[model samples]
Target: MQKYSERKNSAIDKTANPESGNVQPKPRRRRTAVNRGLDENGNGKRKPRRQARRSRSGGFKNTFLLTGIEILGLSVAAVCAVIMLLGYSAGRFSGTSFFGHLLPFTAGVLVLIVAAALFLLGWWKLRQWLRRYSEFLTPALSLSLALLTPWLVTHDQFTLAYGNFRTLVGGKEEAGRMTISHQVYAAYRRHDAAQLQKMVNRAQEYRQAIEDAARSFAVDAHLLHGIAATESSFIPRDSHDGGRGLFQITRVPETVIAQARKRLNVEKISLDDPRHNAFVAAATFKHYLAEMKDDLFLGLLAYNIGPANGGLRFIMQQYGATDFTTIQPYLQTLPRDYPIRVLAYSLAFRLWQQEGRLLAYEEGNNAIRIQRIGIPGLRAGL
Candidate 1:
């Protein structure tokens, strides 16, 4: 019986053994919470750690970008606002006396600060409201404000304000410029309207020639017209002073004549021909203008003086004169007021071109308006 029982157990062991030819299959592994990517208690699956960090970092970058854009927009708007408001305030508070100007200016600045703070608060609320509709609203509003500021400055009140601001900040050079400019204004005021009107009418025929020459030499046409008006009154004649044609063609440098010849593409220059006369005049003026370092007043004076007496440079050096102001006393024999008269005439021409009539300086607010229009060849403020 024991041997039979042992034989049955041996038969079962052979069936379970891998070395035996008849083999049984192995059992499958049981599933668990850890293998299924869940906690031991069978909770929700955990996300990848790297993926979670990436999501938070992306959110932070987006928030930082938005904050930077907002700050940039606000700063631009603030800068533009400050420039315009400060310009206006400085204009209003300008006074000759130190304390008189300082006290009022300080008070105005304080008021502006308060006003700006209130404006910023209101803008912040508006920005918040606008952000709900569109994320780009803040930048758009800032761009619009920048564009609007330039247009606002073009208005008469703002124009005056800008001029006052320049005056306040300007140094001795500016003071000298203002003094000379006022002289031109006085000369313009003295001109008879009828005579000036006749001169403008006479210039119509020569306008094409003058403008062509001006373009060829990169000169201001209105300024050339002033030179013509002062020289021949647009009459174009041979003078007793050895001057010929419309510009009172005096002695011009050989280089100027050569440049004029090159520009006209002609073998010979004829002062009788209005075109040739204008080209020569333009070249001559350009030469002197460069020699004088583009100082308009000095250039005009040099043009009027021509190369006579070793030119204006030599004359200035002889008297130890440095600028237009210092050279005036030494010009007893020369036409010291030539530049002023020319500029005055140029201003008249500009006024006629813009307003269709010459503005009388003594007329109500006409002086300011004309000044705002500015002299030709000179840059206008604002």
Candidate 2:
């Protein structure tokens, strides 16, 4: 029995120790401290902790993505803001090519679109606090800026822009109907104020001749002055395709000259004489005025292009039009814009006479400030 017990014990030890060259099943590994914490139901209490760690990592990634997006949206909005500000300056909108005129409007619309898009993006990507403010702030600011744009642009001495803005508001139709002279005056005022001032001063030298011509032919002295200024820049011997002398008089047939001289009751007329030139110009304007039945627009046009193609009768019979607006389109090769230039110079002369000093058309601080007054049917006329 003792021998049998020893053999059985040896067999058990061999089974326990596989290295003894006996075939035996391998022992299972002992559970680590972490695994030992699991409950008996096969569900680990620590599983929720692992899940929480994964959720935290994913949340951090989402936050970083949103931050990048918000930065991108804000950057675009900043660029749009700069564009809007430039558009509101109103410098690029006048007397330019069609593309130039369109630039401000197009830029404004584009900026508005970008601002709106940013506002929408902010709704999703911005932080909670930032998003709350961005929702209404973006659109409100954009709309307010747009509404103020025209007023801000009109505050400058940009004459064309001022007129355009006035027209837009629909209170002053006359401002929109700027004569050719107004455009030229604005150009000279902006680019060559000194030159304009010099011309006005030199006009005084011919004041006596202009006065004599006005009295002889019953023309306005300011009209003669403005015509001379517009035609020759107050230079007595200025010559052009129109002819020679201070008035830029076109040479007529000897018979026509004699007839004009008879009508004016003047003798010994010379084109070179400043007084004679002024007298002839006044007489010619008067003749055209009479020929056109006192139609001012046609008379002015005929003085430049002659009665054959101009004047009230010819324009009415040929083009079936009676008003200046209708005849303007048919004018060409006769300095159609000359009257506008002359008229504009006339206005400047009047202003100078009134103020005793020319006002510098400063860009930001201009003299033409049209008060906003609501007029019924003003916008409809446009």
Candidate 3:
């Protein structure tokens, strides 16, 4: 009985040590990764400690926040710009189909809403919180949008659009710039359908001449229109400021006029008749633009404010600056938006051409021309 009882106790002990066959010592409990932490109410209970909150990378934190804010702002601005562009686009294509009215109206309303949202965000919740966002995101967003530009430009509509975009002075030239500039288009321009239509029609009259000039200067037609509009309202009338016709070209000093007449074997040009006046004006503007090596704005300033020789000296002195963007504050009221107005007209002309408002003359084709000759050259052979 004693031997049996001893054997039973030993058997029970052997069963309890299930892994005794293995030679390794009993494994240790894996130390919990988290140290013991206080419970929710600060009581001692089984709780996990966090991993020290990633050590608070202050610089990274600030940068991330700033990036987020900048993205938000740029997104808003981009939407606003697209909306405003749609507005102008609406008024531009107003007489078309049902989609036309719907497009512009929706665009106009959306532009206002986007602009208002940006304004509110800037004024209310994100004034300072997102200040760094603009700084950080502007360049990055510009780069991202710029990547799409080449692709956008390659499309037929956007190719024509890119050609037209090259003509606007202060407006957005690409998608990135559009993000910020859409706000300006919305706030400043009213998109008057009638005025735009008239301006478009007026631009048609001199389309050939401007196109010719553009080819000559390797310049944009819309820019030429802007200059012409400011200089003479495309009326080809004389300037009250001793300037000539379409581009408001001024007479050479009487002495210079005499010399030019002798040199070119020409007579004094009349400044009253619109056509002749436009001829002289465009030629003279071409000369000035040439002299400036196509610094169009300076040439224009010379046209309006009178440049000494090529208008460089006065431009530097009066505007108190060298950059074009900085010129606005230094200018007198005689010509406001001096650059932008001309740029607008130039852009308008480009739009007309893209939209087929201008007849293609194919360089020298006479299918659409009415040339005057002593012997009726147009009917001579036929």
For candidate 3, which ten residues in a row score worst on lDDT?
373-382
For candidate 1, the TM-score is 0.77
User: How would you encode candidate 2's per-residue C-alpha lDDT over 205-255 as one tens digit per residue?
Assistant: 888888887787776676677778877888867454556788888854355
- Cα lDDT tens digits, model 1, 8-66, are 89888988887988676667878789888899899968799999999999989876776
TM-score of 2: 0.45
Full-model lDDT, candidate 1: 0.87
TM-score of 3: 0.40
Ranking of all candidate structures by their TM-score, best first: 1, 2, 3
Q: Encode model 3's per-residue lDDT on 1-382: one tens digit a residue.
A: 9999999887767666766552445578774424345454556655224433443566678777766765665565555345335534543554536676666666666767787778657644544544455645443553465456445434344333332333232244333333323332332244454666676777677777666645544544556676776666666655577676666666444443343344334576555544444444445555555655565555555455554443544656655775444565666564635644565444445445554543232335321121110011011110
The CA lDDT of each predicted structure is: 0.87, 0.61, 0.50
Q: What is the lDDT of residue 306 in candidate 3?
A: 52
Off by over 4 Å in 1: 1-84, 106-125
lDDT of 3: 0.50
